[model samples]
Target: MTVTFPHKTLPWLLIAPQLLVTLIFFLWPAGQAIEQAFYQEDAFGLSREFVALENFIELLQDPYYYNSIGVTLVFSMAVAVSGLSIALVLATMADRIIRGQMVYQTLLIWPYAVAPALAGVLWWILFDPAQGPIALWLEYMGIEWDHFVNGGDAMILVVIAATWKQISYNFLFFLAGLQAIPRSLIEAAAIDGAGPVRRFWDIVFPLLSPTAFFLLVMNIVYAFFETFGVIDATTAGGPGQSTKILVYKVYEDGFVGLDLGGSAAQSVILMMIVGLMTVVQFRFIERKVQY
Candidate 1:
């Protein structure tokens, strides 16, 4: 006897719970935030008036808002590129090794397991002025180390912390992509007198584009949003708001400053920027992908 299955109803049944959760948790909150962005609020988070676009206009006119936008862009790009480059290099190197490969892969990817907050604390321990090990070492070595006095130091520390935390994730994806390539293709390229560098650029690189693209998008999102914990722990939006990215500013405005409407406006701006970036990236890369 053969069994019959109602495929359409089963699929919907499986997806119903997920759809309901997303609507309740994600869609509802997003709609509320969008609504809040346009409304004025009182001290108790009560809606006082319909401000209708005023918050958005204020966000655009404010210099601090513009500065936060610039900081967010710079931090996101720096972290994404540095993390991807380092991860790609490490993944390629690991792909060439033969012995104890799993051990090395495990060790290299272990940092991805660490929470961003924990990683931020570790960086704080390393870079904290007057108290950190690096600070003490610099003092002993007669080298002045002052992150607080230097804006560049703060930016560099944030970039380094973000990149370090994300590199392992990118490394794992790249390694998987590298391993998926057929050895026969590489052998053929080598037989046709393709050098290692030539093979990499012409063959391996193109094949790995999908993986690179995936990581690029994920890295941008992570750097933009998830790195807030790291930034908060390390600098708390800094000695002079030097390290305050858009999301950090949003958090500061809503939670610390008690300006929920303003924070919602900032959040709306971030969502717009992220949405634009994603659309532009997809349009740019979709054409380049070879089927």
Candidate 2:
């Protein structure tokens, strides 16, 4: 059955608010960034000169910019894989609980409610080399733990913080997907003498592929963009820029370094990278998804 709106104007009116918001918040800012990418502006923004692709050329040649790109790729992949993997495990465990499921799920989800910056701070405090219990314990175990000075440690800290924040979100979706799977299929697989691991690999996981793929894309996007707060709070791209992802580099250059044109160019490039990633995922990766 086809449901038609009585008036075309009404249909437009219903979407007007969303369209206006997108235009004002997203499209307008994107347009401004694209324009700024081509212009060289001073710190005071009092004078500007169009420089076409100079900012982009400088960035391409700068090794630090390339470092940031590599860091972002590693960070995004780590966060997405670890977050989804851990969440799947938690969701599977939670799915088997016959009691206290609400409490368990609630505790699992509580991390997601924490603000990103706050979560970063929480992890920072928990891993503080001087006083944090975890750091102290690691020290007791004869392993040095210090993110403040070690670049590898700093990267690990940011990755852990980012992944921890995303796990709850992945958990919610994984739980929903797990619940949506028919119980009869599992029962039949069990009757056929399949073990839990065999059933999961052969039947359950295939059905969950769609959910996993969606979470993969979301987690990558989250790690790329939403992790700025976590990095800013914890490492600030410090320990010799080991943890500085592309998004944080954009902020660092534009706001902190006062390189307006370069920062705008970075932002534009980041936008293009994300757009291309989304396209590639849907075009190629989605083929393996079951539903």
Candidate 3:
């Protein structure tokens, strides 16, 4: 009475839709982008020149392009570390609290559900240098806080905004990791006269490493690629070009400047950077994961 099916064919059937969608939506566009990188468009929006690597050479030689790369790396690393650290601390604290845990968890994780663009808009209202809540507060305290001109303040805002958006996601992952640890393990450690620090180091941290590794990669990816909205809203690459991350630069070059070919080169470089980073992260973390 059991139905038999071809397992080999079943796997393809299950993945056929995804593969087709990927081909149509991702691979096709990627191919087009590569093609576009080699051609220059004129005023009439026609491909006027077959430029080969000319666009790429220009991008490589541009100081603004190099500066954008530096800004992107700095912002990405700062957000990743700060977000993961805060999330880990908050997760650990939440795991220990007994009263109103659900309320606190809901509040902490709610930020993850909000759209990044919306979050950027909200922060814009809160940190406006002239008259926003935070800016006004600074002024009231007789503090001179002008993010518009100061690169450091702009970078700090970008990092803080990016980190705030991602901490909830990291928290959710850490919370799940914490919940998966068996109470019996902690009890056994306690029975063996292990103190809080000893138990955490000996047992808790080892179990949490998997979740931490996953969050590290995810947070880095989000901070690198997805914080463009916040940058666009808050700095627009800024008073100068201080906040122009690679993605923002790509958008600016392609759409704003209409230097589609140069932007495509930038895009290709960004793709390579992200792809390399992901490969490196996987190589390093693959050995550390338990299961």
Candidate 4:
């Protein structure tokens, strides 16, 4: 029923369109960033000067840059861990529901469809110190909930927003993985006198490791780069740069500060960091992740 292209040249020709798209869209932009990183151009683009490694050197020397790195590391870990753990728990509970399973899945997954900025706004409104219901309740409890000036509070707010936004996505994957697992295994384990907790730990959890590992990597990457809109719409990396993650810093420096070279250098550095992290994950984590 299907036609096969046996010739290598034919296969290449068949995939040429996708290859061209990748080259034009991904490779070209990456190349431009690398080129721009080594050059400093005037704000107006009237003058351009080559300054090899100077931008990177300055970033290394800047204390704020280090602060951003620390903030990003903390933010990424918080987002990834919280999101994945909550999603997994929800998925497990959903799997057990004999009734209203579809309704529950739909309710859990609908949040992922919301735009990042909108999600951030929703959380922001919920935590707004002046009018937010949660904030009012916290105030009643004698805890002053103001992320405006408190660095730790700001970090927690952003982390909560990011984690909430990401949970729906991780939930989707985890639910799918749970569904794919054979029901026979759980039954057999029960027959072997394995209780619910033992059955889940020994059977279900092990089988879901692949999906969990994949979600872990994707969640980290999302927190690193994709949560820019969330941060921008909610905190704008403000409160004295308390929640200024690396990507937000890049945007602030390049677009607002007009430091094109510095931003490009930051972009390049981020690419390298992400690449190294992927490599490390695939090397070590992937081993523990069963197929």
In the range 35-149, model 1's lDDT, one tens digit per residue, is 9998888869545788999999988898988888888888999999999999999999999999999998999999888988888888878987879998789789987777787
* Candidate 4 lDDT, 108-131, residue by residue in tens: 998888888888899899989999
Give the C-alpha lDDT of model 3.
0.87
Question: lDDT of all the models against the reference?
Answer: 0.89, 0.95, 0.87, 0.93
Q: CA lDDT of 76 in candidate 2? A: 96
How far residue 99's Cα lies from its native spot in candidate 3, in Å, is: 2.1
C-alpha root-mean-square deviation, candidate 2: 1.5
Could you give me the TM-score of model 2 versus the true structure?
0.96
Model 1 Cα shift for residue 253 (angstroms): 0.6
Stretch of 10 with least lDDT, candidate 3: 39-48
Cα RMSDs, all models: 3.2, 1.5, 2.9, 2.3
Looking at candidate 4, the ten consecutive residues that score lowest on lDDT are 4-13
Could you estimate the TM-score for every candidate?
0.91, 0.96, 0.91, 0.96
> Alpha carbon lDDT of residue 26, candidate 1?
91
Q: Which ten residues in a row have the lowest lDDT in candidate 2?
A: 3-12
By the lDDT metric, which is better: model 3 or model 4?
4
Strongest candidate by lDDT: 2
- Greater TM-score among 3 and 4 belongs to 4
Q: Which stretches of candidate 4 lie over 4 Å from their true place?
A: 1-8
